[model samples]
Target: MTAHQNGTISAEVSDFLLNCFVRSPSWQLWLSLPLSLLLLLAMGANTTLLITIRLEASLHEPMYYLLSIISLLDLVVCLTVIPKVLAIFWFDLKSISFFACFLQMYIMNCFLSMESGTFMIMAYDRYVAICHPLRYPSIITDQFVAKAVIFILARNGLLTVPIPILSSQLHYCRGNVIENCICANMSVSRISCNDITINRLYQFACGWTLLGSDLILIFFSYTFILRAVLRLKAQGAVAKALSTCGSHFILILFFSTILLVFVLTLVAKKKVSPDVPVLLNVLHHVVPAALNPIVYGVRTQEIKQGIQRLLKKGW
Candidate 1:
């Protein structure tokens, strides 16, 4: 009789936990439709521009190569998160299986880390261009740029792998209702029955370490760039230097702000509106995807001219 009572109690607890994690229906699906369309359009424009740049021989340069890499990363980042979000909205798959959620979280972090690394490399490129103009060609050679890209790819890829692996080992006996539309790392971590102290600690360590290093390097590079720009005799030279760094600077700022906000939202103990994080995460992903193409289109004379010519040709 005692054994039978224990089994009944366990079953009741399991049912309650499942209900807690199950996604509730809402009218948010209608809103996601238009947002998803906008995301699709932005992704298409960015990919198209990136492909055109790559195919055109004249567009081959360190800057354009970096831009191509950024575009590709942006594509992967959006593809990783937005589709699942749209699917959730459409199908109301509120409770993702544990494995699927971990995969989604892993991929999103991988691309995000890659993007951060790419921006750091871009800052170094600008530093060389502005501060070491005489040796820019030799220092940032095609071979060197390719190697740097490979290193960035490897570093981000390797570093992010452990996060998902660690997350997968955790046992989730608590409710799994992820407040956000996407499977965010912190959201997943919060649902674990086992003590998540290590997970949280690792997250903080990883977040601060990567972001701190990148930001510091970027700050130092920009400092050198500013000094070099100030030393220039001609206004035109300073203006051109500023202009060259403008798009990259804007992108870095946008990426950094979004990342910081997301991280903060994750770490905060006090619960804010769930929608706030969802909106911020969506904006964080979508805005950068949209801005990359627009920034390049507006700021790059060659790209602008190419776009204009293409439009004129109706091709």
Candidate 2:
């Protein structure tokens, strides 16, 4: 439990301090109300969507399966970050055990990467569906879906595990005050007394490699999709094509926009208040999770019909 000389710090490094942006204690509890609402909405929406997808056998396509995976990741992301965040905000519980902090950090990193990977799989699904509809049936088959799942899990899990590992290997001799709501990698790493260049570079590399590549490929996918659609040159064809990608584009847009904003906020942290980046980081987890199912699940015709049938049976 003590120092490993080049590895771990002394066992005295017990807990890390988790910080948030609650101005006044009494008024801060009020902020939890909105956050609670978001959590409820997100969890409820994703759960209901999962049940709908499960019960409705007609929704057994690879696209829907991928959508279900997205919902599942959303659940994991929200659960990992938000509840502890609420506890911090409402109950003044700012101290997270060393192990717990690392676990949270790991989950956050793994699932964020997973979420991005899932989106890429999803975009590829869309690309095949639109760009090569005739081959889509064979391209996005059961085996394909299974492989996509494996890739998403394996890539993100393998790459992201290093982030928390690298962070944990550092010595935390300094005070463990994390200047954010969640146990983010950079937040936790910045508290270390040791040099954080490797930690910073690795995080940067992972972000650009995982998220950047996903975004680039997804962008190319939709670009090709749009090109294919425009080449149709028929009346109402553009609208029809846009409609298919509309929901996905919206969800992916929100996903990328929030992440970009978070990165920008991190850079401009000096210009703005510290709480802004922290708040953005916290919101990035919830807002996407909350909206993912709503945009992809409820808006999809089959899922919508399934929900309607469920409600009709209930009523």
Candidate 3:
């Protein structure tokens, strides 16, 4: 793989080594406990939420159905990256095969976008519930949830497939040591001998398009929702409306805030330590996953009641 011919090395690479926070070994040691806890929390919480939603017939509504989709995506994101991160931290298992690396990259790319799309749909769901209450039942139906799920799956799956494919096409002569924990598209492509301009440009375009569009729509939905919420003159109406959206809004903030910080750090990479972005990148995967179900369970009365029933039945 290292042999260079005509300014390019062989693309037939076997495995890539992950350099996961190696500069500060103590940092890994400190991080291992919290990271493991977060992984367990994410897995357990999402599983509980999924099972609760499934068993509770009342949760078959569009909002809960969308929540289940988010939980599923959270589970996928955690399983994709956290176990390997824990392995790297504890057992020093940093070597990932070429195929596995690219597969991981694809999942991270696709699932994250799908999660964003789901969030957008959820925002629309809330908008309808709050702004057009009378029509929400008809508008956000089983059919609507099904079509939204299909859109998320198709859009992210089709758009992000090219990222890993383009990345794999590049020749990797600059050693197989990936500086980040996971096979981040940029991290892997940076190690390639080929000009990664196309890869970088395409990734930027697609990523921003997916996330940007989702965020914009979410903003508009919430804006209309806010306007509708403010006009309510009935007692407790504003509180009820805000409470309904509180959990989703908090999750969206956590997800988008971390991502925004990561992007800003990447832009100011020259000023910031390189590890900041890497650390944020890793946290971005697990933190929201860990928080999603917990927030919903605590804030949503129905979910809390459903969980209580689930526990009682299990016991």
Provide C-alpha RMSD values for all models, in order.
Answer: 4.1, 3.3, 1.8
In model 3, which runs have C-alpha deviations exceeding 4 angstroms? 1-10
Q: Scored by CA lDDT, what does every candidate get?
A: 0.74, 0.85, 0.93
* Residue 10's lDDT in candidate 1: 15
What is the alpha-carbon lDDT for the whole of candidate 2? 0.85
**Residue 105, model 2, lDDT:** 88
**Segments of candidate 1 deviating more than 4 angstroms:** 1-34, 264-271, 309-315
lDDT of 1 by residue, 1-315 (tens): 012533321111221111111233453645587668768876887877886686566778887888888888888778877776676667654556666667777878778777888888889999999888899988988898799888887877777777777777766555444566777766666766668788778777877766678888999999999998999998599999999999999999888888778667756736764465566777777778878878888898988877776667676
Clash counts for all predictions: 0, 0, 0
lDDT tens readout by residue for model 3, 8-100: 556669999999986667778889999999999999999999999999998878899999999999999899999998999999999999999
Model 3 weakest lDDT span, ten residues long: 1-10
* lDDT of candidate 1 at residue 292, scale 0 to 100: 81
Worst 10 residues of 2 by lDDT: 22-31
* Per-model TM-score versus the true fold: 0.87, 0.93, 0.96
Candidate 1's TM-score reads 0.87
Instruction: Show the lowest summed lDDT stretch of 10 residues, model 1.
Output: 10-19
lDDT of 2 by residue, 175-290 (tens): 67787788888888888788999999999999899999999999999999988998887899888878888888888987889888978987887888777777778888899889
